[model samples]
Target: MASEKSVRIKDIADRLGLSMMSVSVALRGMPGVSEKTRKAVKACAAKLGYRPDPALSALADYRRRVRPTMSFAQLAFVTDYPVKDDPFWGYTNEFLYGAQKRGQEYGYNVVPFWLREGGMTRKQASSVLFNRGIKGLLIAPLPVEDGHLDDLTWKYFAAVAIGPSMASPQLDHAVFDHHHATQTVLRQLHERGYRRIGFLILRRRSTRVHHMPLDAYLGHQYRHEEDRRIEPYLPEALTAEGFWRWFDDQKPDVIVTDAPQDIPRLLAQRGLKSPLDVGLVCVSGQANELEGVSAIIQDLKAIGAAAMDRLHTNLLRHAYGPPQHAHGSHIRGHWQEGMTLKK
Candidate 1:
């Protein structure tokens, strides 16, 4: 017998005494082929070690089908904060959780990149990312001083920011609506007959709280012509000693802030309890318990998930252009009727 070359569809058809088209149809598991014949074709193909050419299959199928490589692609979660000691606590971790969940679904792996040690120059960071095959980037909130990030671009990559707004208009992003969120929270407080509400913000002028809540408070006060007060403490002044000094002097009836754990404890030290002497609400309520705390509740996990969805759309659709200003989903937080708020 002639040296039998690896069997092709033609050989199977010749052995089965069927037309090549019928054998091809049976092998493809297409309709019109009898079930018995389909099984026989499959068995013969398997025994002959016959493999379909993927390129030919793709051409026949017309629709492109790219199988994900078993190896996971790296996705960079870049931020300016220190990796080990992020001041926002669960904020970055929750965002990573969302990213990782989506990444696993799409056969990719997430790798966090912290720009510590004086930060990496854009060129240096880009080179490192390129070398690592990081084609997707989810930029967490960067300080305003980080300068222009528009220079960071790649041919086969998609990038998104995960904060309220990016200074650079050249990057796509999804962020919390601090202004609207503050407005909603304050309006709810006002409706609940809390006229003398006060806002306590950390001293850092660059922090988002300084701009969102503080500004919204000022704006709401002007719009309603209601008497209002705001006390700004140094970021370091978030300590118990520093909070007490301001609390003693300002004496806000109801306070809106982010530090539920520390600030509420300090209030109790002075023989004050929420909803009785004063009401307390936090802008970002990631604290362990909300029994006595009302908060705006920034959903960091949703923000991360939205960022990944946007990145995936951009990559798959080949949407490359200057960053488009896209608004993210703003989940309006409900005013939890904690003991901290009186009905």
Candidate 2:
């Protein structure tokens, strides 16, 4: 049996009739070697029981930290939203910022690529990414009508989707725990003496995420009396007229919605007030920033950082393509108190 010390990169190189430099580059996932050559080199190394030297890896990591130019790893944040009026602008910005910040810490540059603006088909985009040496992807939550990216070359890179929107490739995902977030908010509201808490969201948004929040709400309702449970107010789109109609019909003591904007305004139109006549809470992003609103604030920045962490872990383990087991991570959002909910 060949011992670890007996197997080396040069030994594998000589057996494969390749240069030591080529073998070294292949093992490190550098650009010098073709993908086929890299695969061959890795196979040979595995057959020979080759293991990397921990000290050397540590040294390389230190050098990469001290001198970023020494490393060439690049990742991408793929999205369809444009720079202006981005659908996910406020909600997903933290994810972008966190991914970029953490990626840099690991000597990997994470850049954003707008799929719509590029005017390229999925195949064309893949070619561009391949030529640019982008070996990792952080897919953002997509619009309801378009989410799947099946044409992209999955085998060539590691990928982690931000949410359930990118469902086709079924890549590993990092997402806010919508179920837990809803349960938490309901629990808090109940504790605060709110019985009839109404849940509201755009129908498309809820359906896009497989109605995880709605599921939680439905599940929680069973725990309370029938009158205490309010059916969710799902509208096809936002309109003051539609919302007012629902509000009037439900007559809820509190409202829980993804969009907290205009809740006060809508309440004012009915000669009502938040926490005085009706209470309000948000199960969305930017909750802490909402004045007078208690919320289950989704920490998008933390979710982004977590996604990068998962990507890096896969890179280190030589895991690529759609994950065999398709691991997913759900980060629970925190409860933030403002003046929206009564004390």
* Candidate that would win on TM-score: 2
Per residue, candidate 1 scores C-alpha lDDT tens digits across 23-89 of 8867653334675887788777777777777687767544322444355667888876645456654
| Candidate 2 global lDDT | 0.83
Residue 179 CA displacement from its true place in model 1, Å: 2.2
TM-score of each: 0.65, 0.83
User: After aligning candidate 2 to the native by TM-score, how far in Å is the CA of 236 from where it should be?
Assistant: 1.6
Question: CA lDDT of each candidate?
Answer: 0.67, 0.83
Candidate 2 local Cα displacement, residue 111, angstroms: 1.7
C-alpha displacement of 37 in model 2, angstroms?
5.0
Candidate 1's error at 209, in angstroms?
4.7
- The alpha-carbon deviation from the true structure for residue 31 of candidate 1, after best TM-score superposition, in angstroms, is 32
